[model samples]
Target: MNLAYQAKRSHLLIGLMSGTSLDGVDAAMVSIDTDEQKNISSVSLKGFHYVPYSDEIRERLMALCSVETARLDELVVAHYAVSEWYAYAVSQLLAATGVSAEQVDAVCTHGQTVWHVADSTPFPGPNGMMPVRASLQIGELSVLAERTGIPVVGNFRARDLAAGGVGAPLVPYADMILFRDAKKGRLLQNIGGIANVTVIPAGAALEQVFAFDTGPGNMVIDEIVMLGTDGRQRFDEGGKIAAAGSVSRELLEPFLADPYYRLAPPKSTGREVYGKAFVEQFTGEARKLGLSFEDTVASATALTALTIAEAYKQFVFPGMQAEEVIVSGGGAYNDTMLDMIRQELPQGIRVTTSARYGIPDDAKEAIAFAILGHETLMGRPSNVPSVTGAARPVVLGNLCF
Candidate 1:
């Protein structure tokens, strides 16, 4: 169903993203039209797809992720390789669309995040604090521009970090604009490799918004799947295996009570906190207590859902008065996780996927980056201060000519 509104657009952009889900690249082709106030923005996603990563590349990427300096050079090469890979995906997508390069205005790529240490930063020269600001997403946009012969806007996180923000959950800015409901408060929860939320108060000023990381989303669950299945599975498909297992409340209770869950908003985390080390600690403790593999996976999934609901109640709802939690990302496909969230949510707060708004849950993030690219090319700020904690609104994303 082609929405009649977007047919009048003057710009069409394709956005690509490979999120924390560690699943595959999601590419979305959107045609957008914005007005002088930037308030009258209309967009239609003309096409979208989730292309799974080849086993070989997926393994290699996973192997290099969050590795120490010993593999720094290798990781750098991997980043560039992934960019080319994404370009190839985009080229195929365009070819399949029968839309010429001339018909497309740009390609927006989220690249890939290996590690996000938004809590700290490298030394900032001879004086002031390092701004605790630095993030790396390596899929050279210039190469994408060169290969696709389309102006590309990528590396969107650096600007936020430069302005003293967590530089994570940048997608919330897109959520605020695209998903806000004028009648009811909206809590947009994305369960990618990482789970984060954006709270938009209906009819409130932009500054009244708030968003942040809710804790490990698919990061821990994927790790457990890989380990328990001996690398046979990239993820816990459909939550079937998880549903068959039992959650260890004793173990899960303590994990849920983690201080990170209690921390104030604007906080961020990555594999650094919930990665291999975190898994090792979790497993080691489980072993010490003689927990079963099923128990481990079940608890990890529970933690992901519980943390989101807990965060919403404590921080977001109180401020935004959210009555519905719109879900998206790979986690939305996890039936067990969804069940936990639906059960865990307080009465009156309904849970639904991005599909309710005509956006494919899997491709929403990729589409969002494409929208951000649209914003950047038009000389706009994509940062939501309430979400990113940045110093005022600033135009984000680096343009690679």
Candidate 2:
């Protein structure tokens, strides 16, 4: 029960994430041990928790992402408040689980992403030099570190984006390290607001590993539920709405045709492409087709399943084959979505949650970053060039103590 015990080689981290959907804060207390050789497999999930945001806060954050910039300044302050909320979550997790944060090596926080225009944004200089493509995550780390008295490694995405990597779908590094199966080869699939997958073929070199955003995850489904349910529910509860109605391939086929789904690995997306505006378009099309609320939900779920399934059969699997697909994130909890995936998948591909292997589906993304922090502490690079198409292997994130 003494969670304060030092790791074998003096490395341990608590990873934190509050994703695009603004659902809540995820915090995981992890134990990491590594040798001088830099081969890491020793990992333990000591504790974890997902703290839901209050309705007021969730709405405020959502508004900023789509609101008038004249009111943007307040959103920046709200981001700091997010970090404080994150700190509270981390503290509650330790107290509830009997873990001591002071003993941990680092706290890896994937702060909330306000804007992720990787290839946009104006460069700051004379003569209005066009701003290079970059992104920003705006949870002040100093708040978390100062409040918790822990070394915090945040801004996980900027470094990779700066180096020309997509800076998204970063979980693949953890996938290759901890989830790879030498015999069967494995595919680690995350279905958050966006769906991404990493292919770990048996005997595959790091160069051979591949990953990318495989189209819609929960973004569309959640959005559809929001409008259809009049905000009574944040998402399609257990996909019951989807189950209640039939899908119109007409509404879904056009989405399936989106070029983003067909994009190869090293590609990334966010609320930018599939945010609320996109959902409005979906609802408008469904209405034009005379679809019911239930039908719209069903079509939205169909899109999620088809995109992921299509990405695998089309882009992810050619020379490589994965017998088992390990699923994680909020989408894994939706039975109807999973059923859709099972229906669409080619025969013999088994679907299971990452939680079955002791990683909470909701906690997996945050936990991956916690693991990434441990890697960075040990002089290991968390960005995989093959998977992310980064120009080179570079350490990700800026550490703030």
Candidate 3:
């Protein structure tokens, strides 16, 4: 650990995030303030930058994420490659902000989640059967620290998983810090590759907040779009393609029936369940139904929207009184996804993007990990037990000094 960081009341830290989307490394230079009570009194984003992955890197990451394609040697190589990429992103961010590494406290990175298994996943055990809840986030902190000459915090999910938690949706803790409203109940919905919601009741305390992944976000939609475009395009980009096509209930219903959706809160998921293989199955279904490219993309988009509303209604709305859903992540930019969500949502609830509050939809996740990094340095237990089904609260993030 950096001695200077230990003694500071406020520190400038770069938080890094590489989500399931295989998009890019997002770094946010954040200025965070903490009090004697170990609570965040003030937090602000100083600067942010995103460094996209090349086609080759994205392809390797996709292979490593698959059981049939993953190679141990490539996993090791990609791990270091991702760290270098993250270090490069940090340099770019500092240049963009005119800041130096020595002036910063640390780089807190969520790394890249190659594989994640929640508590509900059964595995063979010593004497009987048990749930093997574990997670992996590459981009080694030691490598990052060596490259950047800055204290690094990495592999944040391990601690939570060790404590018998889902090791995901760690952003909810940051959501409480960044989006908690005193007078109004708000839902912070992050529609990244995988969609998740953080339900904050009006004036609710830390313990009252709850969150869970709401099932497929832009992950499925992007996959369908990629297939349709033959890698010519990456995403729907404003929902133009999806808007051009009609939703197919035939295709969307089976996805809604996924067992993961029926699981209660304190749950989470990732590409392991919704990655290449899943996309292949989805494509197969679309072909069997003879759906056009636009209709397939539209169905995938609607699946995301319908499942989000359904999760809120069945699990969240019963106890929490939320007036609006503050959306973030890539899905927020998809007008078609938003429109579908609004149509399915209850009549009184309003939907809006996080841009309305200040954070850009794309930068919100990156900004979140930055806050979590700060909390970790403060010796704060940042994971919400209520949201992750953890046995107890534990300080997340491993330090590479």
Candidate 4:
């Protein structure tokens, strides 16, 4: 059988995603089929699994995200260790689904984004000092392929960055495939550690799609919870902490004024802007305001909700006027956060989760990469040029067999 022919037909692929939340890995077994033009014809989720990172591993990844603490030796070791965890996730998914590694077509892994800098900075290059945008997602693809005995596709972001893109919100292309509606415009809002939205206009073509990071998602709130609990808790769980307190306007106002919220579209951000260092400043401000820890958490939750609504008001509503905002990722589980977003938005825009559309919030990203990996095998471009500000549509990811 011709390999290219097989790629166009329905095949089983597994996708692994370890998002910015630094909580765990999500593994999804997906069945995808493409049309003659290499466009997705159909996709379905067959099985899914979650593998929580040990506290030690989470700490190590957090360290790697910071420039102040990362060491080259530790980065090298963590890369290999993270790949092992990804392979373990694949093995667990295969076992739970009664499948075998040999039966699968490919494995698509996003790895772990320890550092992502999308803004152009003057740096040494082949042509002397030049402006460059860079991002690093580390999980050794060769190690994963060697362990699983299947071809692997990883580092999906690097190719986009090379093509002059921000190398983020890469899932917008997949969201278009999964959520586009003919008569109703839709906004696919994903709230990982960072929050991003894909705006698809009513009966729009591929060229009309646009997206960008909205601001902090659960990163700040999670950091506050972890700090307040002395590391006993890593997140708000169900937004309970925030629900128990009031949103401190003093704290909330400062956060809402961040310059990132005012940036134009085609922008992206990560821990570099909202990580532990930002959280420390937030906590210091809270202490000065005499606000309790719970109040600070509520304020952070409000920050995420208000910023998302503000992004829509400023960038999305003016053009697309989406009828619904479909929320996903860990933030979807936060009821208080959801309610706040609902209240902050203008009337008549429904807020819901991906589960209503047959995709689990936790598994959506992993499933997306599964689709992207299949595209790579078919020699099709998956990056959305408008969303990432790439020079052109380009096939993403490097294959390892």
- Strongest candidate by TM-score: 4
The CA lDDT at 158 in model 1 is 85
In terms of lDDT, the poorest run of 10 residues in model 1 is 1-10
Q: Compared with the true structure, what per-residue lDDT tens digits does model 2 show for residues 1-401? A: 11332234646689998888778899888877666664664888888887998888887777766634316677768868888898998898889788687676778988887666644556667776665766667789999999898888888787787777778778888877778776887888898888888888987777778888887789888878877777889988788889999989988888777877666667877877788788889999999999999999988888888888888888766778779888898988988889989898878989999989988889888888988777666666788888766788888888777
Alpha-carbon lDDT of model 4: 0.91
Candidate 4 per-residue lDDT, tens place, 64-116, comes to 99989899999999999899999999999999999989889899999899999
RMSD of each: 3.6, 3.0, 1.5, 1.3
**lDDT by residue for model 3 over 18-66, one digit each (tens)?**
8999989888888888788657788888898999999899999989988
**Which of candidates 3 and 4 reaches a greater lDDT?**
4
Highest lDDT: give the candidate number.
4
Q: TM-score for model 3?
A: 0.97
True-structure RMSD for candidate 4:
1.3
Could you tell which candidate, 1 or 3, scores higher by TM-score?
3
- Report clashes for each candidate as comma-separated counts: 2, 2, 0, 0
